[model samples]
Target: MKNYFYFLFFFLIPFGCDNTKGNKLVEKSTNDSSSIYLDKAQKKNIKQSEKLKYYKKSFSILKNQTNDSITRSKLFELTKELYKNNFSEDFLESANLLTTLSTKAKDSFYLAQIHRSKGNYYKNLPNYDSSFIHYTEAEKILKKIKNNDGLSLVLINRSLIQFDTGDYTGADKALNSAYLISKKNNEIASLYAISVMMGLTSMETKDFDKAIKYFNNGLEIIKNNNNLLGEFNKETCLNNIGLSYQKKEDYKKSIDFFKTALKNKSIKSEDPELYSLLIDNLGYSYLKTGNLDEALKLFLESLKIREELKYYNLIVLSKVHLSEYYRQIKDTSNAKKEITEALFIAKKKKTHRDYIAALKQASIIDVQNASTYSKEYIRLSDSIRNVEILSQEKFARIQLETDEIIKEKDILEDKNRSLLYTFIGVVFLLSMLFVVRAQRARTKELMFKQAQQRANEEIYNLLMAQQDVIDQSREIEKKKIARDLHDGILSRMFGARLNLDSINHLDDPESVKKRLEYLNELKEIEQDIREISHDLSREKQDLINNFVSITTNLFEEQTATHSAKLTYFMDSSIKWDLVKNNIKINVFRILQEGLQNINKYAKANTITVNFRKENNELHISIEDDGIGFDVSKKSKGIGMQNMISRAIDCNGKLDINSSKENGTKITLNIPLE
Candidate 1:
């Protein structure tokens, strides 16, 4: 299975009193109005609607007081800030208003800032095309003006959009650029954001060590800037580090980080959302560490905070964890209550993360609900995958258009005939682009259908081949049994019978001695019969005839058929008879599939396959010293897909680790139970 990490970023702009001569009057008028009621305490405590009312009243007072372009631009800035704080549910309106104000002021700096804000707006909406377009415009002006801080922010935001759209490689590159610029400028805030994002991207690709490094680096930068936002991001950075440790299965370290995060005064006292998140994280860590009482206490506390804040999104998140905690303790009633509440919120809000968690919990405690929830989860998963696969290139094109539009508008504003020609050309090109894009989407759909058909055909062929392999295995076993009977036991019995017959033909005196010899021969024959019976008994599983032997045969064939130097090592402790036949076959099939993939793609000279039994799981690892490809890119081969399916069917977790160095290593862990 692939690890997909999702990140949520908070973009902050510093807001302080500008004590210039004209600003004094504007600031006084705004501050004297309802603005004091819209302070941090009121913002966090009151309803968003009430906060918006205060800000709206303040904006109305400021607008009436100012008609000068400079003052009006500042008013618009405050207005947008108000919207971001209290009315961000309608972000598009705020973004449009800012764009109009920035253009009127004829300030590129303001223009870049507004465009970036618009990008963040679209990103919150999860409309990638618009987000990328706005971000691209911001990047254009920031680069031209040589604003490294601004450019870093734009690139980091763009990288986030890229990651959401499944362009992992592109996402990494963008972050790298942002990191370089931020580091060069020694911009601690930008550096903090960029590093955290880099950590998220690494986590998405399951690079836990690198993720920990990046997250800790971000946390260190946060230490350098001990402001409000820095303190908030500090907790977030700590939580992310804990997540990395948790991914590495270092639950003790994870719990330590979670506990440390809870100690942040700003998070605990000021930010309810961050406080609840840290609480939930600590609960999970405690749960994993088997501190059930503490875990439940933390979860309940997190739930209380979220409910009080009326953050329904986080309420569901807390409930999901609560459900799992209850289920672990076999409290079905409470489990059902929590999961039911979570599912209701998910349905109401159309939040997929909550829905998926609810469904997964249903699979464990609610047997009747399992099939229904599982099917719905699968359907939603497919839709999400389709959206992710198709979104990036489309957004990339839109970003290119935003750049051209800005450039053309800059030049076209001064021209008449050239503007006319340019507009016509752009419209014509856009029409053609839409047509081409539509064609491409159609072709992609057709190709997908064709691939599905091909997969069905291949499955049928594999089923036919499976029969042949099974028959061959059975035939080989039968021949071995026959050869043992003919060459060992039966021959011994025949010779004993011949010696007994000779004893009967002896004279009186020699007959007694011959009879003793015949008795000894008869005893030997009886001992031989006992040995044959033991050999034929099913009570003791014979390694030569069992599932391990069958799988070993497959490995032998793989080694013989490939030029790669293949080595296989197995721990002697695994009891093959304890494993189900179907599981054994699935493991064998997955192994064969991996070998096939290596042969086709990994240009390697050596391969090593290792098997071990640890805890309650059987782990199989296959590594190749090959030129590895990016695992972020989805596999194109049917065989690799089949291997993934086989691993899942065997109740296993499969991890395919690959990069340019040390090659690829595929590991599968299946529960022995």
Candidate 2:
């Protein structure tokens, strides 16, 4: 990743004199007078600001010169340069000509370079995945020709795209490879760039000491080279250093570095994005130091620039800082307003950090509001943290796979080297024979190991199968019990109520009084039957089919019994094929338990159930417009545990979002197939 950023930093800077200013630059001349004439025509056309005409003239010259790979390569380079300068239509025209010339001349290097150029163009558009595909295609040809430098550059660019897409580990590996290549080639500028990128990655991962070390190394290189552009990078490094210090609550040092970074005139002139970022960091530092007035001024200034540039991400950051400033000043009205606006922006931009930051600031306003906002802040924080962790894990897995491939390659090379030693071949063959005999002696032992592994797998499968059977049996048993209570007991109770009614109709005064007493008891029994029958019917049946329905029905019944309005929506399209019966039962039990909890603890009204399917996954969502309890401060009840366990059983995901005012949304997504 570091290498990737380094490449971008160097490549993005205009190389040589500014051609836009009509500066006359000397073209390199070769012994071929025809080539010189063609070059002069191209240069004259370019000077006239006619890129298409220049490319056409160059292509016409190159078609005749296709016998020379060098000429073809030059045309490819010129085409790439045109593309970089945004003459995309002319660039494609030149590229197509170069492709034809290269193929006719059988020039793999030129072909590879054209592909690399295409990748760069795509990358500039921020089409990372597409850029990666092109880069990989170029890499195949470059590797065939042993063009290490070209390969390294392509790898670095690919890594940059990966970094932008949040594949930090991939970026790191690519940078490391590029660094190795640059070191071998003794490319000082490239090396320095790679070091800066490494530092940035360290900063991203919150490894301040390592980040500082890398930044310092890069800064030393820049100082030695006297590269003004590299100095601009140093400003970024300083900004990151300040950020790391701020994260650690070392506000004084953070402020110092931030101020130093802001003083860099090169950074100000070269990159508006970096300048805005530095300003935002300065604002954050001020806010942390309790200088609300200074923070607000900087944040608003940054916000104005970000909004003008349509920089959605930085706009959110600025809004969050402004919100925090308002919060610290006890301006509840303004704080609430700014925080709400920040959240809206964050959501629109889909930036987790901004959302979390805004929520955190909002949570600091007042005790009542704080409770609600804090819960939201915590939930967003957890989700972002989880995403980062998962990304890291994926990177680790990729690294492991790469290592395995390298190890296998090494083993193959070792075998080939052994085969090359003709004298040792006989000896090695004899040794192999002996080893094979010894392996035969251990065949029984190997057989036993295999048998053991099979036994373990069989046991595991049996356990899973048994658990599924048990879940099915439990569901069936619950249905049977509910049916018996509703059908048998309720029917008998209804018959007894009828008999009591008939006795009450008789006209003997003494008998009538006893009959009336029996009639009153029968009325109580009938009420009990009605309540039990309702519980045994839809509620119990729903518990068998859908988890969300089970919970929703329970809440609705409670509302009806206790006079509360519980609204719910259950999407009928959710797939249940991949979900085990055990998981279904557990989910049902948890909902049953949760409803019971709301009935016992929550004092407010309106429960809601929302279920849907997205991305080939089923999401069972249960929410309530009731007084929500604190998730972090309070321990989970057995019911909640049951819900979690059921989610695990199905290899499903669960999220419980709740607070004091904002009710809970328990979402469970179980993957299908």
Candidate 3:
């Protein structure tokens, strides 16, 4: 939820190059001593073995050639093809040559393109720092040249890196910026890609409706294009949309989308990755929809392809899902084996998401065995979630540093301009003093008044700046605590779970029961760990939206506890993403205080939390059917002051309405963008 926007933006990058021709390249035998020629058969036969030789020759020729952007572009394309084929040496060499040629040609566009390609290479290598640098450089160049297409492309690429590196917020911003530019330029390919990304981000953030809308828009664009690859992308979007709906417990709609996505399989035989993904998604969908047989069959088919292709990551994911499926059908033995296998792979891969998933499956297995494995699963899940939280915080810190540098640069420039203007004014004043004494006196008085006003403004700005620094420090501390919880406590608990598992295998029944009880206690600890991890990772800004739900739940629980007739209504469909952590905490505290006030004074039997969004604004209404106070006559209390301050902190507004014999309604409106 913290980086929901970032997720949306990062998803758009692949679509930028969607217009490129399908994966078809010229091939030649490495051993064959034949002259290179551009022909249909030769182009169709391109192989990895010959890539280095061909790229080297092509790059050498292009380096010597002058006054030919078109030729240079073609050579760059060849280099990209080489890189795509995993010819690392050839790719780097060609990329370097292309960079030199583009620079000499003074072609900013091509330079940006070369940088983007280099960024892609580094990105695939998982060198996120280098990838981000290249992307930033390319963005600067594109912006300077006012090339919207180039800028959008760079933004998309940058977003991908951010998403991979856990900078979801940055990724979202980059993606949204690219989407606006693409829409303005009427770039269909970019638009479709952006749409897909938006859907993906929405799905990531658990906004099912938004995810569906984005996928639908992307499908519409792909349908209009009549492109096979676009269709493939559309299928992926549909699969994700279905998965999102499934997460929200909408089985009927999820099944519908999964079936629709499977309707196209023209290239499934040629693209194992695509085929495997589709099958796995379908299997998962079926599992969710209670179609055990269909789920098992699809999952098995997917596992086969994954094994053949040696896609270990996907294999781990599939195995865990299958384990869950088997467990649902009461096949405990098979479930245990599959889950154990998944755990081994997850440990080997050190992939946090996969590790957490495997642990979740293992926990289900523990339910049947009544063994310590459940504790182990919980421990591992907690550890993985903690690490994820730390990674997210690290990314946020890096972005903050980058932002600070830009702000400092702007301040320096402003100071320099002000100094230059002051110097010029002084010279003019001295030179014209005698000629316009009366006018000069008036000007001096005005300057005196302006200087006094400016001084006061500067003092006010300094105080605000100091407050901001303090807030930032607090945020950083919170992130540190979150990281510590994830890395230290969670990891130790997991280790404890492993120890408990060892105890469970002992022969003595007495020891086994003792170990099982210990494991159960650990399981509770693990649950607490997960809850804390999630809470820490959640951005403080999202508390505004979460408050409505939280308050509604509290009201319901209170009613049930007190045996009072209380009616509570909530929208339950409002979508929100946390923009910052500080905002989230403040909003949460404010809501807490409001609820406390209601419990003490409102004396209401019913409550309602209404949430709605209009463009860039968010609206929240909390009302209770209780004895209300007179707003005009009653003095403002500490709770009101706290709520007002919280609203001001987020640049939001709060309105409170109440009267004798009537319930109170507190409406909070916040700007989201």
Backbone N/Cα/C clashes per model: 0, 1, 14
Rank all candidate structures by their lDDT, best first, as comma-separated numbers.
Answer: 1, 3, 2
**Cα lDDT, all candidates:** 0.71, 0.66, 0.67
Q: Give the per-residue lDDT digits (tens) of candidate 3, residues 1-673.
A: 1221111212334213412222212333333222232122136566645655565666565566664555555666666566656788877887887788778878776677777888788877876655666677677776777666556777777776666555566778888998888888777767777777766666666777887888888778777774533336666667767777777888778778877877876736756676677677777878887888999999999899989988777888789888889888988889889987987786676554665567666766756433444554565556545544554564455445644534465564565467548644653563365237546756787678657745754664565457557756866887888888888998999999998898677889999888999999998998898788778667554444433554566666766665335554444344443335445455555666666778788777766666566666767677877889899999886458768977998899999999988888898887875
Candidate 2 wrong stretches, greater than 4 Å: 1-49, 60-71, 96-106, 228-231, 265-272, 308-310, 343-673
Query: TM-score for every candidate vs. truth?
Result: 0.49, 0.49, 0.50
RMSD of each: 21.5, 21.2, 33.9
TM value for model 2: 0.49
Candidate 1 stretches greater than 4 Å from native: 1-11, 14-110, 124-128, 163-168, 227-229, 400-673
Checking candidate 1 for backbone clashes, the offending pairs are none
TM-score (C-alpha) between model 1 and the true structure: 0.49
Using lDDT, give the best candidate's number: 1
Angstrom error of the Cα, residue 125, model 3: value is 1.7
Q: State residue 250's C-alpha deviation in candidate 2, in Å.
A: 1.9
Residues 1-673, candidate 1: write the lDDT tens digits: 1221222445444221233222223333334443454353254567766766666665555545543445444555564665457466443554565566657756566667677777777677776666677888888877776665567778888887887667777788888998898788776777777788888878888899998999988877777675734346777888888888988889999888878877767666777777777778778888988899999999899889878988777788778788889889989999888887887887677566566666677677767557656775676566556556555555555556765755565443345346447645653564476468657867787689658855754774576467558756865675577567767877777777777776676678877787877777777766776666556543234434355666788788877888999999988888775676667767877787788888988989999999899998999999999999888886656567777877888888889999876689999999988
